[model samples]
Target chain A: MNEATIQVQKLTKRFGDFTAVNNISFEVSTGEVFGFLGANGAGKTTAIRMLCGLSKPTSGWGRVAGFDITREPEMIKKNIGYMSQKFSLYDDLKVWENIRLFAGIYGVPHHTIATKTDEMLQRLGFASEKNSLVKSLPMGWKQKLAFSVAIFHKPKIVFLDEPTGGVDPLTRRQFWELIYEAATQGITVFVTTHYMDEAEYCNRVSIMVDGRIDAIGTPKQLKQQFESESIDEVFRKLARRATRKEV
Target chain B: MLVFLIEKEFKQIIRHSFIPKLLIVFPVMVMLVFPWAATMEIKNISINITDLDHSTLSKKLVQKISASNYFRLTGLSSSHADAIEEIEFGNADILLEIKSGFEKQLIREGATNVSISSNAVNGAKGGLGAAYLSGILQEYTMEQLAILGIKPVPVIKTTESYLFNPMLNYKIFIIPAIITMLLTMLCGFLPALNIVGEKEAGTMEQINVTPVPKFSFILAKLIPYWIIGVIALSLCFALANLFYGLTPSGSISTIYIFAAIFLLVVSGLGLIISNYSSTLQQAMFVMFFFMMIMILISGLFTPVSSMPKWAQLITMINPLKYFIQVMRAVYLKGSGMGELTVQMVALIFFAVGANIWAVISYRKTTH
Candidate 1:
C-alpha cells in the first residue's frame, strides 16, 4: 500500500466563537496530488495552514511526514515546504540570490548550492536569467521560480497556496505541469486553488464549505455522485447546500 | 543560516533603488544642517528704544547697543506705551524704556535704572536676549566710569574657567549629540521599514514556515543596519572633526561602546514595531508618530531640564534621552564611565526588554 504522507483526522480550528476549520478529516498518499478547494473565506487557508504545521489546530489530531501536528510541528516544518498566495521571493534580489538564500535556510550544504542551482537553472532552461532581478521576470516565470524555490530543499511535501494567482491560462497549465513533475519525484503536492477545472487534475480532491469538508473523492467519482457534468457544477451544488455564510 | 540571512539583507539593501544612497547621505546632511540650525545663541535680535533723555549719554548708549551684531534697533518709539506695544505685537524682541531722566541724574547719583521689558514668549530666546542686553549695559557702565575718572570701588572680579570647550562653540556642544540622534533614527527607521516590507511582499510568511529561530531572524535582520549605523556614526565623527572642528574629549572607544549598547535598544524597538505592524504603510505611520515624540522628548533638540516637571519625569523613561545625555556628557565634559553608569544600566535594561519583547511578539505560528 502507498504510505500516507498526510493523515488528518477530525482536525478543527476556532477563533473565539467562530470555527474556521471545523472537524475536517482527510489523507493524501505519497506522490498524491491533493487539491483543497473552497469558495472565498470557506476555510481552505485555515485548514491547509494547520496541515502545513504553520498553525495549531484547536483539537483533534493530524500527522504530516510522520511528525505529529501538535507535538512535532518543528520537525514537521523541516519535512515540508510552503508557498503562499502572495509572491514570497525578494523582488529586489537576483534569481540566484533567492535560490541560495532558501538553500541556506533549509540547511542545504553550502558546497552543493552552486551545483544544485546550476542544475535547476539548466532544467528550467533559463540559466541566462539567473543574475536578473526577480522583479524584472515575467509573471509566469516568477510563478515557476517561486515553485522551484519552495521545493528546492526536497521536502517530503510542498503546500502551494493559490500559487498560480493572476497568471495567464497557458502559464497556469504550465504551472500544473511543474506540480505534476514534483509529484512524480515522490513529493506530496497539497495545493489550494480557485480554478474549478484544476480540481480535476488531483488524485483526490476535498471541497470545504463553511469550515467543513463537504465532499472527498476522485474527480470522476465526485461528478458521478453529484449527478453533475463537471467538478464546477459539483462544487456549486455542494457550496449552495452549505447552511452557514462565509466567515 | 544567520550568515545567509545577513547576506540576503545586505544584498537587498544595496540593490534597492533608493535606500543605500539615503542611508549614507542622510547623516552627512544632518551633520551639515543641525549644528547651524539647532543652537541657543541668538543673532540679529530686533530691539526698540524710547530714549526720552535726548542727551549725549543716552544717545551714545543707544548707538552702542545698536552697533553690536547681536542687536538691531528696529524702531525708535516716541513714547513708553509705543515701545511696550512694539514688544507686545511681536514687532520687537526687547523694549528699552529709558524714562525721563536727564543726564543730570547720572552726574549726581552715579547710577540710574533703565527700565527694560522683553517678550519672553520663548523662555530661552528671551533669556539669551536679556543676557545680551545686560552685557552691553555693563560695557557702557564701565566706559562711563572710566571716562568720568570715577574709581570703581568695591570691584569684585570673576576669573572664569570654561572647561572641555573653552570657546563654548555650540557645534562642539551638539555635534556628538546630533550624531547620537541621527544614528538612532536611521538605525531604527531602516529595519522598521525593512521588516514590514518583507511582510508586505509576503516573504515573511515563507520565513515563518521555516524552522529558523526567532532570535536569529530578528538578529539577522537588524545586524546589517546596526553595522551601517556604527559606520555611519564613525564617519559623522570624522566629518564633524574635519569640517566643524568638534571632537569628543572622551575616549573614542567609550563612545563606540555606548553606541553598540544603544543600537541594540534602537534596532529592537524597530523590530518590535515591525512585528506589530501588518503593512508597510501602517508601520510607516506608526514609526513616524513615535519618532516625532521620541525626538521631541529626547532632549536632542531642547534642554530636558527646561521642560515642565512631568515632562522631565517622562524623559527619564525615553531611551534616546539617555543616549543624548551620555553623548553630550562624554563629548563635551569628558565624563567617564563612572559618570555614565546610570545611563548604561538604563540602556542595557531597555535593550534586553525591547529585544525580548520583539522575539516573543514575533508570531512564528500563523494566526
Candidate 2:
C-alpha cells in the first residue's frame, strides 16, 4: 500500500464547551482525490483546517505529509499547499506577480519559476491573461488559476476549501480537470465542497455530520449502500440522522 | 522569501498608476496647506480696556499694552459690563479694568493695582495672552520705579538666547512636528489598514498557510513603509528648504538614524493595532483614536510644560512625543546623539517593545 500523505487519528477540536470537530480519523494516500462533504456547520472546514496546519486540534495526533501537525506545523506548511474558499489572488496584483509571490514563498527554485509559470499558464489557456490584474479576470478563471498556483511548487498534498463555491458549472468542470491533472501527477488532493455532484467525482468521499464522520467510502459504494440513486440523496440521509440524534 | 513578500506589498501600494503619484504628491500638499491651516503662532489677540481712572496714567498703560505685537486694542468700552459683553460676544479675548482711584493710589503709595480678565475657554490662547500681558506689565512697572528714582535692580531681568531657532520661528518648530505626523499617517496608518485589509480580502488566510515566518511577514509589511517614510521625510526636508527656506541644523544622518528607530515605534504600533482588529474599518478607527491622543499630547501645538502633571505623565508613553522632540532637537538645535540620548533610548525601547508585542500578539492559526 502507498504511504499515507495525510493521517489523522482521534483528532478533536473543542472551543470551550462546544466540540467543533469531535474525534474523527481519516487517511489519504498520495495521488488521491478525497472529497470532504458536509452541511455548513458540519465541521468539514474544521477538519480540513487541522490537516492544513492552519488550525490546531484540541487533543489528537495528526500528520500531514509525514510531519506532526502540532509539533512541526512549519514543516507541514512547507510540504503542503492550500487554497481558501475566499479567493486568494490579490486583485491589485497582476496574474504573473501573484504566481511569483507564492512560488517564492513555497521555496520554488528561482531559475524555474518563469518556465513553470509559462508552461502552467499555457497549458490552462491562461497565457494571454498573465499580465492582467486578477480583478479583471472572471470569478471562474480566477478560481481555476488559484488552483494551479496552489500546486505550483509540487507539494505532496494540496488542500482546497470550497475552491469552486461560487463558480459556474462549465468553469467548475474545467477546474476539476486541473484537479485530476494534479492527482495524476501524484499530488494528494483534499477538497471540501457543498456540491454533491462534485463529491461523486472524488475517488473517495467522507460525509461529516455534526463534527463526526457519518460515513466514508467511494461515491458508488456509499450510494448503493444507502439504496440511493445519487450522492445527494446519501448526503440528505446522513444529515437527517444527525438531526434525529440531536432530537 | 522575505524579499518576495516586500516586493508584493510594494507592488500593491504602487498598484494603480495614480497611487505612486499620490504618495509623492502627498507631502507637497501637506507642506502648502499645513503651514497656513495649522500653526502654533499666536497673533492678533483682541483686547478691550475700560478705564474709569480717566487719568493720563491709565491711558499710558493702555498705550503700552497696544504697542506689543501680541495684543490689538480692538475696543474701548465706557463701562466694565460693556467690556465684559465684548468678551462674551467673542469680539475681545481680554478685558482690562482700571479703577477710578488707580492714578491717586499710584502717586500716593507708589503702587497701584489693576485687574485683567481673559477668556479661558481656549485655555492655551488665554494662558499665552496672560503671560504676554504680564511681560509687558513688568516692563511698565519697572518704568514707574525708574521714574520714582527706585531703579535699584528691583526688576528681575531675563537674558534670553533662543536655541536652534534664533528668532523663535514658529515654522521651524511646527515643520518637524508636521513631518512627524505625516510619517505616522504613512508608516502608522497605512500599514495598520493594509494588514487588516489583507484579512478582509481573504489573502491573509493564504499567507497563514504558507511557511512564511511571522517576523519575515511583519518585516515585509514594514519594509515598504520604512522606505517610503525615509523618502517622504527627506522630501519634506527638501520641501521645507524649498518652500519655507528651512534646513536641518544638525547631521542629516542623525535625523535618519532616529527616524529609522521611530518608524519602527510607529509602524509596530500600527501592526499591534492590526493584530487586534478584525476589519480594516476597525483598524482605521483604532489608529485614529490613538493618533489623535498621541498628537494632541505630543507637545506639537502646545508646550509639554503647560499641560497638567497627569497629562504630562501620559506623554511619556506617547511615541510621537519622543520623535517630535528628537526631530526638533536635531533639526533646529543641531543636537547630536549625546544631547539626544534620553529620547533616543526611550524611542528604541518603544520600537523594540511595540514590535515584540505586535509579533507575539499575532496568531498563525486561523480561528
Candidate 3:
C-alpha cells in the first residue's frame, strides 16, 4: 500500500486535568479529502491543531509527509499549510501584499511567487480584487482567497479549520471547489466543518463526539450504517450516543 | 444636565480596568520611579587614590576623601600614571594624588597643595568632585591657622569661577534627563499599542500561522518606531542646542551612538510588553507601568545618592540612570567614548536582555 500522507497512532491531547482529544487513530491516503466533523468545542479544532504542528498532543504520535511531528516540527511546518476558522487575514494590508508576505514566509522562490500569485488570483477570479484591502472583501470571497493562499506554497498537506465557518452556502460551495482542486493536484486536504451537508463532499469523514471519535466512514456508508438517509441524522445519532456515555 | 452627562461618561470610563490604572496607578508609579532614577549625582564615584607617602596625615587625608559622599575609593594604585589609566579605562572617576612629606609642610610652610585630578568627562560631576576636594583643603587650612593664632600667610586671597552652567541650574541639567525619559515613552509605548491593536483585531494570530520568522515579524513592527525614536532624539537634541544652548561638547557620533543604544533598549521593552499582553488596553497598561517606573527611577528629579541605600541599588539596574549619565557626559562634559563606555555597556545589556526576553515570551502559536 502507498504510504499515508498523514498517519496518526492513538493521538490524544490533554489540557491540564481536561482531555481535549482522546486516544484516536486515523490515516489519510495521499491526495484525499478528509473531513473532521464535530460541533463547537468537540475537539475538532484541537485535533486539527495537532495535525498542523501548532499544538502538541499529550500522548500518541503523528507523522505528516513522513516527518515525525515531535522530532521535526519545522519540517512538518514546511510541508503543510494551515488556514484558521478566524477568517485569518491581515485586514490592514492589500490582498496582493498579503499574498506576497505569505509566499515569502513559506520560502517560495521569489520569481515563482510573483508568477504564481498572478496565476492563483486569475484562477480564483480575484484578479480585479488584488489591490483591494482584505477587510473590504466580502466574507465569502475572503475565506475562499484565504484558503487559496494557505496552499500557495504547494504543500504535501493542507489543514483547513472551519475554512467556511461564517460564509453563505454559495461561497462555501465555491470554497469546497477550491479544496477539491487542491486535492486533485495530489495535495491531501484535511478540513473541519460544522456543516453536515459539507461532509458529503469529503472522501471520508470522522465525527468527533466530545474528545473521542464516535464514528468514522465514507459519508454514504456512515449514513447507511446508522439507518439514516442524511449525514445530519447520522451526526445526531452519534451525538446522542456521546451524551448518553457522559451520563 | 452637563453634570449628569459627565457622570455617565465617568461611569463608562471607570468600568474599564485600564483607565484607572493608566490615570491613577501609573502616574504614582512613574512619580516613584522618577525620583529614584533622575539623578546625575556621582554616588559611589569610584576613585583610585595614589598616596606616595604612608604618613599619618596622608592616611587621614585618604580617610577624609573616601568618607565623603562624592567618591568611593575603588582601588589603591602604585603610581600616579596608573591612577590616570584607571580614569581612562573607566574603572575610576577621580584620582587623588598625595605628595610625600605633606604633613611636615603644612605646619612649617603653612600652605600645602594637594593635587586632585578628576575624570571630568562628565564635566559637572568631575568639577563637583574637584570642588569638594578643594573645599576640604581650604577648611583644613583655616583650622590650622586658628590653632596657630595666625591669619592668611602673605595675605593671599582665593577666588572661584565657573564658565558654562554657572548657576548650575538643575532645570537645564534635567532637560537631557527629560529627553531620555520621553524616549522610553515614545519607543516603548507606541509600538506596544500597535502590537496590541493587531492582537485585538485578531490579525496577530493570522500572521503567526504564516511561515514568517518571528524575529523578522518583530523587526518589521519595531522599524517604524526605531525611526521615530531617532527623529525624536534629533528634535530633542535640536531643542537642547537651540533653547538651552546645550550642544554636546563631545563627538556628535558618540551622542548618536548612545541614543541608538538607548532606543534599542526601549524598543525591546515595548516588544516584551506587547508579547505578554493579550489586548491593546492591556498593552497600554503594561507600557504605562514601565513608563512611570523607568522615568521615576531614572534619577531625573532626585539625586540617586540621596535615596535610601536600597533605592540606590535599584537605580544601578535602571537603564535610564546610565543613559542620563551618558547624555550629560557627552553634551555637557564633551566626553569621549572612552569616558562613557561603562554606561554604554549597561545600555547594551538592557537592549540584549530585553530582546531575548521578548523573543522567548512571544508564543509561536495561533491556538
Best candidate, DockQ-wise?
1
lDDT of 2 by residue, B14-80 (tens): 8756557767888899987897778766788899999999998788889999988899999999998
Which of the two candidates, 2 or 3, achieves a greater DockQ against the reference? Answer: 2
- TM-score per candidate: 0.95, 0.90, 0.72
Task: For candidate 3, give the lDDT of residue B17.
Answer: 50
Give native contacts recovered, as a fraction, per prediction: 0.81, 0.87, 0.35
- Candidate 1: stretches off by over 4 Å: A243-247, B151-155, B303-313, B336-339
Model 3 lDDT, full chain set? 0.78
Runs with alpha carbons beyond 4 Å of true place in candidate 2: A244-247, B16-22, B36-41, B53-69, B98-115, B127-159, B304-314
Sort every candidate by lDDT, greatest first.
Answer: 2, 1, 3
* Winner by TM-score: 1
Q: For candidate 1, what's the RMSD?
A: 2.2
Candidates' lDDT values, in order? 0.88, 0.88, 0.78
DockQ of candidates 1 onward, in order? 0.76, 0.71, 0.16
Model 3: residue B48 alpha-carbon error in angstroms: 52
lDDT of 3 by residue, A1-247 (tens): 3569999999999888888899989888888899999877788888887777677778899998888766666678888888888876777567887777777778887778778889999998889998887889988888888888889989999999999888888888888889999988989999999899999999999999988888888998998899999899999888875642331
